[model samples]
Target chain A: MPVSTLTDPTLKDAHYLVDTGFEHGEMLTIVGKCEVDYDGRASSHLAPGERLVILKPDGTLLVHRNKQRKPVNWQPPGSTHSARLDDNRLIVESVRSSPHEELEITFQTVVQVSRLEVDDVSDLELEGSEEDLRQRILADPDILETGFNAMATERETSAGPIDIYGQDADGTPIAVELKRRRVGPDAVSQLNRYVEALERNRPSKSVRGILVAPSVTERAKQLLTSEGLEFVSLTPEQEDISQPIGFSEDADK
Target chain B: MPVSTLTDPTLKDAHYLVDTGFEHGEMLTIVGKCEVDYDGRASSHLAPGERLVILKPDGTLLVHRNKQRKPVNWQPPGSTHSARLDDNRLIVESVRSSPHEELEITFQTVVQVSRLEVDDVSDLELEGSEEDLRQRILADPDILETGFNAMATERETSAGPIDIYGQDADGTPIAVELKRRRVGPDAVSQLNRYVEALERNRPSKSVRGILVAPSVTERAKQLLTSEGLEFVSLTPEQEDISQPIGFSEDADK
Candidate 1:
């Protein structure tokens, strides 16, 4: 294209393929375009052509970007939190990539301000009342909260007993008791101890006990079934135990 | 243990397990102590009976923290950065869990007050003089200044060419035209075009051509090798070249 053609009004709103002249990542500046969404980087799908246009706050535009846009060379590394101007929060859903490994995130600041945020696809679909939220937390396949502290025969001291607890959708309580390999007479005894301790304290009627493991010992399952306690097995399918949760509170500020 | 025996004089400057009467991960106030260096967290490893001590910047002690460490029971959602002391700067080495994978860090204002700066780890271990530094950049494994730009060819409107144009260690000119994949007859022809275009405009013997890719066609490699041009073959080790050779200065900043 001619130099004059590059300055044409038609291409003003379009994204110009600016070469950052760096190595390893792709960096592009939309002449007059603001990103409406984030498709993985490096795909030309950010929108076709080069153009510039002023956008009103209330105006909406349809942008078709190549899915393969990547970072241009010399660009710093970072993650996108959100793609929309109005949307300020980015939620990254917990994904299990390896067996027997828990995912963790570390940052220097507990909070951040960013033009980008990641939305967890699974977390977006949660909907329901308090009862539904509670049920969802119990059956959530992604996380399992167990109550081990409740099974202590007695308070060994004020040090406190170990307790495994997961919250329900409406902030209810769900306690789970887990077995390492198999459940047997010992598990039954342990469960009895926990039930008795919990009964003494009577934390909440909504607080239910669940026994989870890869394979429940026949005796443990039988005990739980006989006791009428609910139980679930671990699986990869993300079960909605609650609503989409995040703590980006710019509105309040 | 009796409160009278708590003030033992034998324990000084040695690590001791403070009976933090609370759970792990919870913040505790330093209440009482004899003399020791406790970073505020209490470990469970006390030798039957040991006292906890905390040091302070001023001559006076802060407080003794014991029986107050609470275990981290809840992870706040969307909190990305960790807590830093008043005198420390936040440096993000890498992002742990993210939607779009990239490293992130920020330098806070606190470090500026403390006169702390980012460490140059890459340059520390190497024993290099001024000349060596320049020569090292020219050599492989040390990425000095490299960039990419669109160059025009006679047959093509424009082709993406990687440029390794910079000053050598000795302040001499340094420039190279590199092809990411295979070098074809057109590539050789293309390099000649770039060289001529660059030489005609900017005369420098430091400008050269480099063809980089996996194994090239035998004939193509022969031709490029014979012309005294550089060939960066894709060895098994080089197959995974996603990492940059040198750390960017801004990466840790």
Candidate 2:
């Protein structure tokens, strides 16, 4: 059976199914009224409420409430899962080492329990990231500046890796930082660090810093000005890319 | 009905259930083979694979593959959802404005569709947050330093709000930045901004900056030393707080 479900099962029966599911490495979901406790990097307690609990074979566990996309609590992949019954309650616990986190869910009533055999082997292809922005600038350096000469990418400095190292038309050294979306003062600080590192390395020469992003916050603009840096408005994805033909917008029907 | 389930549904049947589920404001889960496309702040395309799709009542959507804690793709709350049949396939689309993002899922075969009525009103009680750390310091200022006086919290500055604004025993103006966990160079820069703002406001007095967290990265420590700032190691939750009595460690049995 690809999916096995038990509705309103007795506590003993639910425990048996959960034990078997853990042993057989099947994905399991339990809908019930439960209270949760978490301890590790942080600590939390959830009062009794009905929730959907999902346990994946790869040791991922999620507790979902009705309203939000993010799970109320979760154990990342590679945790150890166990179940037990005590004081007329069913308890499920997940624990992980190396930073050491533990999440415990105690159920008062089991509305439903399901075990599923899932088969999925697909990867997600994404665009409009920092890498895409870098490619765009590299393919057409003139887009960044009219006389910019590209030298190297991810060039290392004592502070960190400079996103792009190049020279302007005037031949002064330039350190470029890339942000895919809008930026704030943090980006300015990052660029300042790289510029300072370059100046320290070559005491007699002047270095310029430029930040490339779709936009900058007012505070970031002020910080850039105070630090003697520059900003270039650019996005990771081109604006002119058209959507796929035949993609329907009539889904409401 | 609190719950409804359909197995091996035809595309037309699935579409009908999805439409009704959306209208009734129920949480729906669909298990099927599908392809996903997202266009928004970024763009992505996922190839055909068996996945679990969850649609929450408050305009949240999640597509989960078999293995990870994070959804393969998701739409945050406040996105309008709709479904339809196209070319014998079940299509679900979610769209949101104010940045204008869209997510589309095309299902080749739907194994099951379930609508669940979840009752969750209880809020999570969490500890070990930055707020808790602030409270801790407020309760006993000496934990931060002997004779250190706390003047205000969330004190507004041109840079941002200082987590804690105070003075040292020497009566020097102090700006304290707090982090719940280990921090990197960014935290140092943030503290620097607050200190600079204070210095600009009062030109005669030298302002001091302090960072408080459980720990600091080596790079952050270097940045702190170079910028003439201070760091204090402290956790949001005290280490001596004991676990509840009778909390079982024998859960493996």
Candidate 3:
């Protein structure tokens, strides 16, 4: 693997694209001061200042401040990364197709740039949680097999947070409420409020509500039917894989 | 720089320490299921499951689950890392000295291991908000420079969370309440609650209250003095470094 470490004075704008290969698992780390504005799920602003920007081979982009271990802002893996120079500033954008997340960072000045040809991968370790399961459903659209195209996840309504906002195959608006456990009547009531709020705010027509959980009780199903809502049960592949295999003292033999 | 990608079928325990050099700018990523127990700062447990683990050259150890982009647990840089085989598991440990944080991960199985020799870094970019500023004070006691040793951050009491809990050089128990903006009387009231709660809970003697903020007004300072509390003002290093440089239309020309 080859490594190139260059100072800002020696770096050309084309180096972000032509000089390094990022898709082949190459890594790029840039240290600079930047003005960052994120307009995706939410809008945030970072005044121009000294910041560390990392572009990884796996398509993870992180914007870090000197004080915290965690990046102040970042786009998770599977986001598409593009680096381009605009006028006097270098612009890097990371876009995610599923959740429609986009992070744009504009570097006012470049202090340094280093690119590494990364080849060491039997496979990079990737982990996921229930949120990932929701993302998978959004990305595939067919995971539900219910012909639902998830429009959004964790979209906020006046009433509360709608776990999944989408439309049926016929383009009817659908709101989904997610739960890691077996949902009950309280969950139904919460979903009812969210659906009511959505419909009240967008009152051109009625909106549909859907309760999503690993399992839904019969009582909850009755409530859902009474409320004119739907249900979707998801069993993540890792759910079964993550269950611990029981061991006993006798098993040591 | 040499890169090594190996599978456990051909990996020996000694190779974790021998086959690759991690002290130099190298990154080691291990993927497998592990039972993890973290007993520093706070105690957390992770049942056996597939997980991603990363060990950086700077001694930052991260244990990741499949749910979120962030690691489930991690230790900051400047920690010591050691990997070895214990019983039927692979044990990885990272130990940090200041404020003392330790993370231990036991890998139940090994799916893949990759070591990368990295050569790229000019400077690190750092950013942090008020929360980050408070965390930095908690993590490094020496930052106070007031002979105050921060014991724990955000320690919960009946009233609320104490920003910093520690002892002064004279061995007096101190409870700190942090605010990023100018201190006000409401902050004093909150700090008074936290201090009173701490003293009530551990009541052999009284625990003194301290107000920490970026800047304190004269009225707030008078209130603190009247309440028998101390005040510490901080202007984070990152704060000055992060201020945006002015660029006018003339400059654009």
Candidate 4:
């Protein structure tokens, strides 16, 4: 809730009492150029340079460069840390005892240091899953077409989880394979396996396999058609997948 | 960027130009609940409800429910798209021909729509890579210690890329392995292999292997100690790793 900027670079024996209740407790933000040395599985080092160091509330230690999506190097949570300013430098040490790993960051020149306290649960959280998407299709078959009606979701097969099990207007058993990406060869193979298994188990009717995705690959199409399967494109609406189940509060106007 | 809101429940025959000139082009922000059908990897459908669909310039389409970082279901880029308002609904379609993938987003009810345009490059860019970190270490021997000096980086052998190859203070041959996560059993095993290979090839001198990462797993530590290795911890200053290279201008002041 409160933030303080460390004007004086040197600090020692400082204590911060962030809430213990918070899972990811406090974050220490520091900007400076310094030497980086990591001692854990293997010993390594980095030359002194200008960089930003963020000590996460959870014991995860992250080092970032100006560019990239992933931290240059990181230590997962469940570690203890201590920072001390001595001999005109800031020395911060973090240790994880289970693996017996340690991190030492020496700041040759400290520009700024601040402690961040998480105040509220304003962060977004979505409880979205593959099953949620399947349930949606089972609720409405018109999305696929006027004739398509999903009989079941998560149909168990020897092959794997069949997203949808349904029948066409003509009463042919349909096995649907669902994925987020364009249909690929692997999906086609999987659908074929399920269809073959179903057909062998129930010879009275022929089972049709349909590969469903937002898109389909040329390879997938060839594979699907050659294997006697169908393709359907479904675009999911842009919505938060994290909202609680049956919670449609955002667009409730 | 000009943004617009569609208050009308029904939309028909709408056209917008989201240029491919932008790497991640235009982001179409839509909020509402509707069915999501992806006909690609496997046919998939999501029951219509409140969610966010983001169409990126790079052809990546993302559907989100409020709290998750990853899209509930998404279609990757490298596809063509066309949007039209037919009857009282909005139809947004994306297609990839190579693998033949198509994603269709049908909005049964429209609540909001916005287009995002990126127009500036004032961002911090880091040429962040394990190689970059290794280069930094190779450039500065003092980070390792006063007596250590790095001889080479990415030293090629049957064992793979040696993060750092150098000599300790006593001129003893040292092989270094670097990783971003807690050192694991695999990393230790890898280092042991490299050391064994290096020692077998060069019999007269002793070769010391050091495993370096932000932290180490208990198993990794045990493995490293049993194999006679050293560990060091390095925490890099956090910077934006998401920025493109040559764009490091944010903290350049």
Candidate 5:
């Protein structure tokens, strides 16, 4: 069966099904009124409420309330999960080590429980990331600045990897940092570190740092100015200006 | 009915149930073989695969595969959702404005669809936060420093809100920044901004800046030293040493 569901089952039945689901590596969903306690990097306690709890095969546990996108409490993947009937209540616990977090859910009433067989193996292809921004600049170096000669990307330095490393028309070394969205002083600091590393590698040479992003915060701008860095306004998405406004040769087709 | 489920429903039936689910403001879960497309701050496309799709009444959508804690793709709360039948496929669309993101799922085969009635209205009470750390310091100021007297918390500064504002034994004003976890240079920069702001506000008086966290990164330590700031090793959680090791009063009870 692709899915096995029980509505308003006895605690013993629910525990049996949950244990079977765990052993068979199935995704289980339990809707019930439960109080949750979490102890880890942080500790939290949720009062008794009816919520949806998902236990994934890979040891991901999510306790979601009705109102928000984020789980009220969650144990990340690689946690060990167990379910048992304690007294008359069904207790579910998920535990993970190395930082050590534990999530415990005690159910007052189980409204529904389901075990699902899921098979998924597809990768998401994404665009308009920092990588895409780098690609755009590499494809048209003039877009960054006229006479900007591209040299290397993800060039490693003592500090970290430079997003785009190159030289200008004057042959002065330049280190470029790319951000897909509006950034703050941290990005500026990152670029500064890379520039400092480059200068240290070649003490006689001066390296110019440029930050490429859609926009920058006021503090970031101030820091850039203090550090003698440059900012270029650009987005990761390719500009729509490539389409001609008027007549097209393929209009008849 | 608390939950209405359909297994291997026809495309038309799935569309009808989905439309009904939307109209009734119920949580809907759809498991199917589908391809997904997303466009917004970023864009993505997922090839056909079996996955679980969740739609919350508050207008949140989540696309989950079998693995990973995070949803493969999600539209946060407040995105409008709609389902329609196109040719022989069922297409569900979620869209939100102000940054304008859209997620589209085209299901080639609907395995199961469930509409659940959920009622949850409980807030999570959390501990081991920066606020908890602040409380711990306020309760026993000496943990921060000898003769340290806490004055205010969330004190307003031009840069932002200072976590804790206090005075040292010398009566010199101190601005303490709190972090629940280990931090990097960004935390140092934030503390620096607050200290600078405080100095500007009272030019003649010397102000001290201190960062309190479990630990600091190497670069952050260097930056703190350069700025002449101080770091104290502390965690948000109350120490377990409160219990006497050999003789516990609770042992008799």
Candidate 6:
């Protein structure tokens, strides 16, 4: 196993490309998307419907399905007066410009019930198990799963054999571990070992691993790049993975 | 009854002094007072220990009575979270801030039922006789007595007696006619006349009115303002005055 770390500023363009959208002021809609590329793309390779979002504007926010010509509905991020920003022009434009990816509607549930707090796995009245979680991942046609505990093998670490894992719609396996509490060279070594073990042992499907954390040490990011493992981090508002691409039309003005 | 209108914005401002809390980005807490001039002070104001709120932050909203500083103890607005903002905050910040008024806690039911379709409230529904409406208003302390609505009497141009009525809260009132269509400058003029009559009738009380319309004209805002009758062009959100406010703490970086 090897160890490495990296920081966002050192990366080309300061951040890796996760998605693209059409931004008119605070209103943003995913006009198009590039494949989740760890490396930055050249301007010549810019796809017709793809554009970067670099700001968060104040206005209406509407979410709708693919190729829809008008925003189905709207909600103000932080105010009363629900329909304050419902402009017809913006709704039409967003629908006209929306990309092909099916809008992923995250099922949000806040559990304040003490019996079902975050760490209550044993008490969890599960419909299934860890393997069931993976099976559910595989069963999804759209395959956008989030907030599930990762499955790791007994490849071992200073803490434990418990590592992070992800499964795609077709059962492609990708493992990820967080160095959330601390950042150092050893994180790279640790993630690399997990990746190597997963690859060599050959879990039930195609396997890859990602090292995800808030901010990676420079050395770790550099070495991971050299070793070809994915590295991911947050950029302010985008930290909420479930938030859709853009602001609503009313939000723009 | 002599008829005149309130054309001065300053008087309107004074009429709406207690309502500045509902203004943009401002907060209002109804610290109940037995008496005061409205710097939020009181000669005999006693704290009722309940707080209600209306907040608008950058990307977050808060419209709940956050009592005891714990999640479970929270209640939706109007019930625990009153329409007033200060009452909501007092339940949490009472330990530090001095009491300014004796706040009251009135309850209203707020249920979450989506896709509310706004249709016209029929003229029949909108057309209860003046006596019936006055009786209905007086019967519900939760209505007029909660300081949401205040009634004023004045002379009308076409109709002899007019009721100058404010909205549910301490907002601008309307020159309501039990049966009227094609609300014109006369309806406008009559509303102004009532405002004057009401002021003369009750020299101590502030007077305002809305001329209820099946549809208000494009020039209605200007016409109403010129005549000194504050009218509300009811939006769908305003119409759903009973909707409960919900709170969710989203983790943002």
Q: Give the top-scoring candidate (TM-score).
A: 2
Task: Give the lowest summed-lDDT range of ten residues in model 2 chain A.
Answer: A244-253
- Deviation (Å) of A11 in candidate 2: 2.8
What is candidate 6's lDDT per residue for A1-253, written digit by digit as tens?
A: 0101111122221121111111212222221122111111111111112111111122223322121222222322321111111221111111111211111111111000000001101111122223333343334312323533344434353223534465644566766555433344456555655565566566554566666555777655665665577765521112234756576768878
- Report, for candidate 2, the interface RMSD: 1.6
CA lDDT, every model vs. true structure: 0.29, 0.91, 0.67, 0.61, 0.91, 0.32
State residue B30's C-alpha deviation in candidate 1, in Å.
73
lDDT of 2 by residue, B1-253 (tens): 2777777889889888888899899888888889999999899999998888899999999998779899999999999999989998999999988889999999999887877888899999899899999999999999888888999999999888999999999999999999999999889999999999999899999999989999999988999998999998999987687878867869846
Q: Write the per-residue lDDT of candidate 4 for residues A1-253, one digit (tens) a residue.
A: 3344443244441222212212345555555556667766445676666554556655666554433333344565777767766686777677888677777777775555545442222223222244545655677776665688788877886444577888888888889877755555556666776787688689888898887677877766765766688887864432455758767867786
lDDT of 6 by residue, B1-253 (tens): 1111111123223224323323332222121111111111211222222222222111111212211111111122222111332422212111102323222322121111011011111111122234444454445524333454545544343224665354446564434543223444435544554565456656776765655543466454555665566543321111245634443335332
Judged by whole-model lDDT over C-alpha atoms, candidate 3 comes out at: 0.67
lDDT of 3 at A201: 87
lDDT of 2 at B170: 94
What digit string (tens of lDDT, one per residue) describes model 4 on residues B1-253? 3333333334542233222222345545455545566765445666665555556555666655433234456666666666776666677787877667777777776554544442222232334345555665766667766788888888876445677888988999889888765656667766766786688778998899987777887756765776798887753322355857767677686
Model 4, residue B23: C-alpha shift (Å): 15
Q: What share of the reference contacts survives in each candidate? A: 0.00, 0.79, 0.02, 0.00, 0.78, 0.00
Docking class of 4: incorrect
- How accurate locally is residue B176 in candidate 4, as Cα lDDT from 0 to 100? 88
Off by over 4 Å in 4: A1-253, B13-25, B39-44, B84-89, B97-101, B126-136, B196-206, B238-253
CAPRI band of model 5?
A: medium
Model 4 alpha-carbon miss at residue B93, Å: 2.6
Model 5 ranges off by over 4 Å = A196-206, A243-253, B171-173, B199-207, B243-253
Q: Please give the distance, in angstroms, between residue A43's alpha carbon in candidate 4 and its true position after superposition.
A: 23
Task: Evaluate candidate 6 by giving its C-alpha RMSD to the native, one decimal.
Answer: 34.4
Candidate ranking under DockQ, highest first, comes to: 5, 2, 3, 4, 1, 6
Q: Which clashing pairs does model 5 show?
A: none
lDDT of 1 by residue, A174-206 (tens): 455554333453344344444444544655554
Residue B119 of model 5, lDDT score = 81
